[model samples]
Target: MMTANPYSFRKVALGDLDLLMAWQSSPHVQKWWGAQEPYTAADLADPRVARWIVSYDARPFGFMQDYSVHGWENHHFAHLPKGARGIDQFIGDPDMIGVGHGPAFIRTRLQALFDAGAPVIATDPHPDNAQAIAAYKKLGFEPSGPAQETRWGLILPMLLRP
Candidate 1:
């Protein structure tokens, strides 16, 4: 049996813009993530965020991004420790949902962050996004506070401490 994780992540690049745009436009993705403008060169070069393409068994099927919790002024997670990170992700391939890839890839990414000395990791999923909330819970995230509206949307703050 193959014991190694099947998920792999690669830094998203300019060349991936078309693919990413298509994924972002998918109905399932658009529902949760909203209409996002196309990423610009400056957006991709932003120092505080790391965007990735997630693949399972070498097939790209998702998008994920991690950012410094305190990168933006008055960010809800700013109170977290200095090295804390915030993550947002979605499985873009409709076929990949409910098949275990969300938690699996998220686990792999979170492990990498924790191993690199992140004191905590945070995620803010919409309160009604039960699937997302359940997956986060399975990965050990717990509610840090009540749901609140932010520029991004209404989210339930959750955190995973290393």
Candidate 2:
């Protein structure tokens, strides 16, 4: 597991597969979660798909990932060392929505990547998530146009100081 302490970031373990599959199948998360079929245990075990277990306050609250090189969207970050290590996440419990933790989590994650020298950080949400779009802007992400009729909403390439 890879962790940046004060905030714990751990590698996805076999035990996490089921939990991830739960998020993959959630109704609210589904509209924008790529609309792929519900994930099977074997799918979660694939080495090609990277996963990070996002826990907060002693409870699992979210999921983070960088898909396989052969997958969609990741092509935008294929130039990186790992081919796809930008950023993507979903808060598992709907109760956490609009509580302001999202902006903080996103800020921390991007800072962690930046300190590690990541050249860029990116994420795409379904165009309908107005709340998410507003949150990204709060974290300094600006819209960079749409992707395949899907508005990517925001992409934070590199944080530049003004």
Candidate 3:
């Protein structure tokens, strides 16, 4: 059996912008996530999504965001059942990679979503991101459909049902 997750999550704030930018520039993140402009105050204030900074042992090392699948018009995950949520995340600290933190924290977050009444959780990772695909599989996410190109990029849609 798995032990309890050691990660904690808090909302991303303006002060985290620099850290987020640095992480996005890391080769590991950049390879799979691509470079992203730092989030602005307006972006964080967007009601459609909730962004978070994930920590372990009180040290911040990752970022995550979740949003309503149907919040945006023409969203790739719009076909999911009502009340489904979509999540995107990455481990920022290179030292934290390959230590099982990804799956542990993700499972913790998914449990929270289920406890809050989210019937399904959706994710769309780029088809070439084998590491991410494998982690999601270990967490019980299964391919919901074939790969498709969307505004976000080419993704293999996956979902987990509680």
TM-score of each: 0.97, 0.69, 0.96
lDDT of each: 0.94, 0.62, 0.93
TM-score leader: 1
Q: Per-residue lDDT for 1-162 in model 3, tens only?
A: 997557899999999999999999999999988879779999999988999999997899999999999999999888878889999999999999999999999999999999999999999999889999999999999998899999888999999999
Clashing residue pairs in candidate 2 are none
Residues 20-85 of candidate 2: C-alpha lDDT, one tens digit per residue: 778777887776665655555676677766567777765777877755433555454454444334
| TM-score: the better of candidates 1 and 3 | 1
- RMSD values for the candidates in order, in angstroms, are 1.1, 5.4, 1.8
Which segments of model 1 are wrong by more than 4 Å? Answer: none
> Which is the winner by TM-score between candidate 1 and candidate 2?
1
Native-to-model Cα distance after best TM-score fit, residue 161 in candidate 1, in Å: 0.7
TM-score of 1: 0.97
Error of 2 at 136 (Å): 1.2
| Candidate 3 accuracy as lDDT | 0.93
lDDT of 2 at 148: 37
Stretch of 10 with least lDDT, candidate 3: 1-10
Q: Using lDDT as the measure, what is the rank order of every candidate, best first? A: 1, 3, 2
